[model samples]
Target: MIRLVAGYATAALTMLVLDGVWLTVATPRLYKPRIGELLADKPSLPPAVVFYFLYVAAIVVLAIQPALREGGWRRLLTHAVVFGLVAYATYDLTNQATLKTWSTTITLVDMAWGTLVTTAAASAGYAVMRWIGK
Candidate 1:
């Protein structure tokens, strides 16, 4: 239980910090919509574009830890589920982020992006562990 909780907490907090730096210093472009009206005001904004940026960042982080993804598919999948929980926890922190949102397609894409990322991270981490025989 402790490991599970810790894993999720770490992942969620990491994303929040990443989001902060991303919104504040690295890429102000990501946060432009944070202030706009949920739906009526940001039709020009593309959800895929937004999620793409986030997933790219997360993937970069995972890439830096190549050992994480060296494991077999079964082990990778298990860790991915935990990562999914973390991702969902992070997303849930602001359900309002989806309020007055755009079409279901956009939301589905975003969700898929999150799921893929979480799985990738788990696979990456598992690989790393297997490489190190940890």
Candidate 2:
């Protein structure tokens, strides 16, 4: 139980940090609103940061063990990548359409970053699992 909570929390924080980096350096010019803004606006939600974090963790939880248990790095990585992209793309497309901020360029950029970040976050969590288990 503790491990489960930690997994989600760790993922959320990871996403938040990555998001900060992206906002500060990746895409700062076009007024691209970030996770911070989203979360701040709604106290109920665990911030958009948590959304991404939970996303990363969820993917790893569902896909990682099965992949690692059954195959090799290729399988694990592939599962992570597919799940990450789907989550990222879904979030971006839904928000873009609703907010009327649709843009192919942005969509691709977000998807790319989301994929990379989600993979990184999940991998990081996996790396620290031993410590977390205790």
Give the number of the best model, judged by lDDT.
2
Kindly list the per-residue Cα lDDT of model 2 for residues 1-134, writing each as its tens digit: 66656655665667678877885685445334443343333234456546665566676576555554576456666776788789879978887878744666667888888788777666655545535644
Tens-place lDDT per residue, model 1, 23-99, is 35522332234423443433345874566456544533443233244545664465455555556556644553655
Roughly what TM-score does model 2 have, to 2 decimal places? 0.65
Per-prediction TM-score, please? 0.39, 0.65
* Candidate 2 deviant stretches above 4 angstroms: 1-13, 30-45, 49-53, 96-99, 130-134
Candidate 2: lDDT of 30? 35
Number of the top TM-score candidate = 2
Report model 1's TM-score to 2 decimal places: 0.39
Cα deviation of 79 in candidate 2 (Å)?
Answer: 1.4
